[model samples]
Structure formats: structure tokens, C-alpha cells
Target: MNGTIHNRDKFLNQIASRLNRPRISSKIQKPKWKYQPQHEVYKDATQDELLAVLEEHCKKIHTDIFTTDLQGLPAVVNDVVANCGGGPVVTWKDERFSEWGLDSVMKKEWPSQQIDVFEWDHTLGEENIDKAENANVGITISEITLAESGTVVLFSDKDKGRTVSFLPKASIMLIPKSTLVPRMTQAAVKMREVYQKTGHVASCINFITGPSNSADIELNLVVGVHGPIKATYIVVNDL
Candidate 1:
């Protein structure tokens, strides 16, 4: 039995015994309700306008934003990696990286000892995670980019682990223009559609607005206490 069900049954049985009645096995049901947005602000903004809004919010949160075409992505990636001083780099095993020839570009620009691509079937389990945790730079693709809040959504899977985004000193996300949405509501609807079609959702869905920060102790602000110290989003126009 599920732990929840077993505990519920045990409690119900104890109550029934005290009351001199039989325990019930019926399940409780709750009414389902549809969620309606109170305000649909910027529902009609153009792509350029949305991008501008996203850039403004990103700046407020101290997230660096870079815009480039598909052909320029490799050069942009190279620059970000170079800024990290050529330490261990971790990336997802996404096909988009290969399609954009990032592998070849990294090989040409950096040595083989500097890059580590995470593969799902690899046997280097704990060792691989350690490398990613110590990496100077981590790169991944964003599933959804909410322009309204300057948030990037990532779904973790076997190939795309959550550590790739959280463990590194600096995190870089390559977001395609098509993945950009006007608001978080639209991003949620899109993810719902994906789950409906696939009959499954990722184990973890992370919504990152900017670099990790906390101001809990004595109202002193600290960045990267739990995640990357720096975060960058590269928006590719010609996805």
C-alpha cells in the first residue's frame, strides 16, 4: 500500500473501533476549477517589444543578456566559455548543440581536457556529478523563456540534469526566439500541452529568474550561496 493510504486507513480504523462502527474505504473527491488570469497585461506585445521588456527586467535582477543570430551562437558561446578562464565546462547532451556545430567550435577553440558533456548512459555517475559541481561554466538550453518576468524554465531529464544549471560558478542558457513567451501563463499552458501529448512530465521543472540570491541574515544581500554566482541568457533570433 502507498504510505499515505496506509496511514489514513490506520487512523480511520482506530476511530471506527472506538466508535463501534466499520471503517469506510471510499475515496474523497474535490471539485476541479479552471484558473483565470486577473490581468492579461502585454498580451498583444510584439516580439521585439517583449524582448525589450525581458531585457529591462533581466537588468533589474542583474542577469546578463546577449542577443545573436543562429550563426553567431558558436562565437557567443566561445566568448562566454573563455571568460571563465578555461576550467572544466559542463553541458547537456542536447541535439541542438550538435545541430549548431557547438561541439566542433569548442574543439577548435578549447582543449579536450576543458570540456565535459554529460551523457545519460555514462558510467561515471558520482564522478561526473563532481566534475559538474566544480565546473567553472555550465551550459544548457532553455525550454521556455518568459519575457514578462525575465524567467527561464528548464525541465530536467536523464540527458539534461538539474546540476548543470545549479552547481557551476556561472550558468549560460541558450534560448531560441520561438521558445520565448509573453508571460508565465503561456509557458504553463505550453508545458501542459506537452504533458498531455506525451503522458508524462519531467522529474523537475526549474524556473530561474536570475542568479541565486538571499537577503535573510541581517538584510545583507548575498549572491550564489545556493547556485551560480553569475547567469547569462543568449537569445538566438534565427532559431
Candidate 2:
């Protein structure tokens, strides 16, 4: 115990001596102001125009398009699959979605359980991930995300499971208009608001930009390396 105390004292004295020995004077550092400037005033087009923009962008990116009327999502999902291709495995967990009439919307030839809706608990160890990865289509509802950069923010809570977005062939996300922020900085501000109010931190937070892509080997851009090959973002205007 005596030797340990002496070692601690020696460390403290060394730190103090180093602090006291700094004698060189330097000019005060000027703050870096606005490295990247943001727009002074924000302007958005009409709802129809915005939807048109989204559709055009999605088409250019070769993403299967879908929209949620917020009245009945299960029905909308049916059209989304039919538009993409028949026989897609629609995986959803929300009870409301299940109740929104999925069984009836599916085609007769498709198996009864092809559209599998399971109630998932995040506590379940890696099982949901396996299910999502095997699925052809995965659906999720985001709390909010930035529309401009096409970024989807998953809060990584019990309801918004991580695998829902990450481990699927294709992702279909439903984001309410009330939660849509324009830019990345706004996303941080919204997160801060939640932190200040709830005092609750998440287990994980993911910011997904488009589909999983990589250019590791031969410097050639490759898609679907880490996650889904295709992603569809459905911005629900009505919250």
C-alpha cells in the first residue's frame, strides 16, 4: 500500500511539473466560422411537386416505388409488391399492419404464410436478423429521417428493430411527414430535443443512405455488399 501511494504521488507530481513548465506564449486561436454554408432561407415546393420529385428520383435510382395513405398500409403494400413483382415475401411486425388486411390482398397461388408478419422482441437473439435476411421484402416505420439526403434514421428501440432495415433484400420504409426533417443538421437537433425531454438514450442509432454499397475490390462500385440491394422510402404525408 505504501509503494502504491508513492507511485500515485510520483505520477501526480510529474503531471503538475509538466503543467507548470509550459512557458511559450501563442496568439489566441480564431474560431472557424461556417466551413460549409447552409441556405439562409428554406423553401419547399408544393406537396404534389415534392411527391413528383421523389418519384422521379426513385425511378432514376431504380427503386420500387410505394406510398402509404396512412388509412390502410396493408392494402398499399399489396399494390407495391404487385408493381415490383408478384410473390414477394412481405415481412411486417406492427399489429395495425397485420390488421390492415394483408391476407386478403395476397394472390391465390402464393402460399398462405408467404406474407409472414411476426411480432418481434428486440431481446430475441439474432433470430429476427435471420428472418429479415431471408425475406424478399422488409417493411419498417421510421420515427423520422432527412428527406433531402435520402437518409433513414432508425432509433434502434424495441419496436424499430435494427435488422428490419439492415438484413433484407429490399427495404420499404414508412416515414410520417410530421417527422421528416430537411437536412442532416436538423436530424441532430431533433435527436437533441428527444434527449433533453426524455433523458433516454438508444441502444444503437443508424443513418442509412440509400442501399448497402461498396467499392472495396478493384475500386469498382458494387451494390449489396453489406445489406439490402434495393430500398424504397414511402413518405406518408398524414401522420
Candidate 3:
């Protein structure tokens, strides 16, 4: 920590000396908004209302959504995988898969059907990334869901490789309905809460709305230019 601060100060001091000004080491204060408009959208909305907002936004982003309860979650996952043309699937090695009661689905169920499944293993190094890149679909659990933009926030870990979501042809996000928020405002609050509790936060926090869309070439819209060609969100109501 001391070395990091020293290096930062040295870099800043060089710039200050070049500009003929004293180095400012104090932290900047965040601006306080008078109206606080960011917190107002769907402030009192129920979970169902948030889901409605997410459903509408998904259409704009060309993503599909499926709602199911805990008991039906396994079926939903299976159907989504099938719809994405069966896998070669890559997923995060997260305990939440079992915690949310889908352990059998990931292990026994899929394997029995002859669908290849790969879990991101840090021990395997870059081999995990290669599997994800070659897979038909990547499955991940959403840390937070932003309803206003149909976005899923992911905090990357060693077991949760960043490539799993972006490298696959299609990405599957398993979102628990209770994780839904009205917009980015609440999501930001949640992230701050995570940081406060852990004393640190993930360096790679992703806010993915849908598949990659680009028009850089000749003003024509194209999908899958920079990421997955298809994206699906499976919202578990009782998870």
C-alpha cells in the first residue's frame, strides 16, 4: 500500500513540477445533488413492476427473458440452452449454482443429455478462456439486475472469468428477481455496500445489457461485432 501511494505521488509530483504548481494530495469531495432525482425512478415499485420494466427494456436491446420460480429454474435453464442450440457451454465455478439449487442441473442433468459443460477453473489458466471462446453458450449469475436498462452487473472473480460472458456465441444470465433494481443508482448503492463490507471491490465490474451491437462500418447495424450474438436472462422469482 505504501509503495502504491509513493508511486502515485511521484507521478503526480512530476506533473505538478512541470506545471509549476504545488501537488494536491487531498481526496476530492463528491458533489451532492440537491434534487436527488436518481433515486426516484420506481422508488416504491414491487418486484413484479421491476420485472415489467426489465421485460420492456429487453425488447429494445434484442435480448430474451424468461421468468420462473425456484422449482422451475432447472427447466428454464435447459430450455434456454436448447434454444441457444445446445452446448459446448462454459460457466463460472460459483457455489451459488448449488446454493440456488441447480447443482444437479449443471452436473448430472446436462451431462446425461450429452451436452458438454465446462466450468471456469483458475487452476487451468488460459485453458478456461479458450473453452469459453469455443463454447456455444456461457452461463453466469447476475450480481445485480438493472431494470431500466435490462442490464446485469457482474463482479469478476478468479472462478468467474470475464471472458465467459463475452467470448461465447450466446450468453445466459441467471438473475434472481430479488436482485432487480430500478436503475444504475440502486446498483451503485449495492456495489458501495459490497465494498464497505469487504474493504475492496472487484476491478472488473461489468454492466452488460445485451449482445454486442455496432454500426462503426458504413452506418449499418450489426450484432455480435464485439461480443455474444445472443443474450438471455432467466429470472428466478423464488431464488
Candidate 4:
């Protein structure tokens, strides 16, 4: 009878506690990086295979290309855009982009005339986002990464707003091949340290593997339903 009464008291206490639970949530800052379950370092993969893997994982074929060096930018962009039927490519204003000789590539290539290239300025306001989404391709250069999960990090200060990377149907990210890291943990540590020293949290740190995708409906996988349909990265070493 004593044991039964003890159990009854414990249940009553739990019920009372639940009834008087606090209304406000704590303001604790969680870890900056979200750990993806399948986050593992892909090894011994060729560039072609890497591209193939990204495409396979995202379930969408992308003609968009990413390159870090200001030099190979033209070739990669031309190759990817031409493959995608030479549609308009929207890019932000940057000296590196100009150094890539994008103008020459545009003028010399037969497809350039068919494609419209727009340079974005901050003055465009929110409406530019809609224009980027409607365009055939969106291209931007990345800072660099250290080649573990094939992750690319974007800082919001680059003027290529976070939306520029995510909102488009196809995103082309160019990173210096040297930026690849071997693990997600290393990336997280670096990010944390940076925040500690700077005292300013990175406005955005987007880790885009390929394209945005989901498989939630009756286990039926779908691609490009919610976000971009495709993503491509050109690990440029020449820059």
C-alpha cells in the first residue's frame, strides 16, 4: 500500500507540473551548424563523379557551373549555360567576374546574343529576387572551402544575398578547389571561432549540397518542388 501511494503521488506531481509549465522559451543559442544524418566525407571521387553524385542525390540534372578563379570563369559559365540552351544568366557586379572576360565570352560565343546577361545592383530591391527566379541561370563566386562533404559556405556580406543562392531554380557556385574540407566538424569549428573573434554572427551560412529536395509524400521523392531544381559547382584551381 505504501509503494502504491508513492506512485500515485509522483503521477499527481507530474500532472501539476505540466499544468503550470513556463510560457516563455529559453533564449539559448543552439549550435550554429545543423548536423545532417548522412554528413560524411566522400573520398577518392573524380570531378565528373562528384558532379554526377550531386546530380544523383538531388535527382536533377544541372547545366549550371561554378568556378572560383577569375580565369576559368568564362569557360565554365559558357559550357554550363550553353548546355542549358544559352538562356539569360543573372550575376552580381564583381571585378573577378569582369576579369573572367565574361564580356569577351559573351561577344565571341554565338549563344551570347541569344542569352541576356543582367548585372544586379542593390538598388533593384526585392523585385530583383523575382527576376532572378525567372531567369534561366544564376551564378556566383564562393569564398573557398577545406573537400570533405563537398559543402560550399556563403557569407551574406558578399552582396550576393542568401536568397540569391537559394531562391533560384538553378544555382551555380564557384569555389576555389582548395576550399574543400574533409569534415563538417572542421567547418563548424572554424565558423564558431570566427564568430567568437568577430562578435558578429554570420548573417547566413548556407550549406547547399546540390539542389533543394524532399521525399515526404507517401515516400514518393520529388525534386525542385520546393526550392531549386539543380545546382552545379566548378572547383576552380586556376584563380
Q: Candidates' TM-scores?
A: 0.82, 0.69, 0.90, 0.64
Give per-candidate clash totals: 0, 0, 0, 10
**Backbone clash tally for model 1?**
0
Whole-model lDDT values for every prediction: 0.82, 0.64, 0.92, 0.63
Residue-level lDDT for 163 in candidate 4? 68
| lDDT tens readout by residue for model 1, 165-238 | 98989899988877888887888898999999998889799999888999999999899989999999999885
Decreasing lDDT order of the candidates = 3, 1, 2, 4
- Top lDDT hit: 3
How well is each residue in 78-101 modelled by candidate 2, as lDDT tens digits? 566555454345344565443544
Candidate RMSDs in order: 4.2, 6.6, 2.2, 10.6
What lDDT, from 0 to 1, does candidate 2 have? 0.64
lDDT of 3 by residue, 1-239 (tens): 54434587778889999999998778989998789988999999999999999999999999999999888888889889999999999999998788777878888988998989999999999899889989999999899999999999998988899999999999999998989999999999999999999988899999998999998889998999989999999999863
- What's model 3's overall lDDT? 0.92
- Candidate 2: list runs displaced more than 4 Å: 1-36, 39-62, 82-113
Give candidate 1's whole-model lDDT.
0.82
lDDT score of residue 173 within candidate 2: 74
Residue lDDT tens for model 4, 34-136: 7654345564555545544443433333324343456656777778767655656677666666565777765556343667666666777876677677777
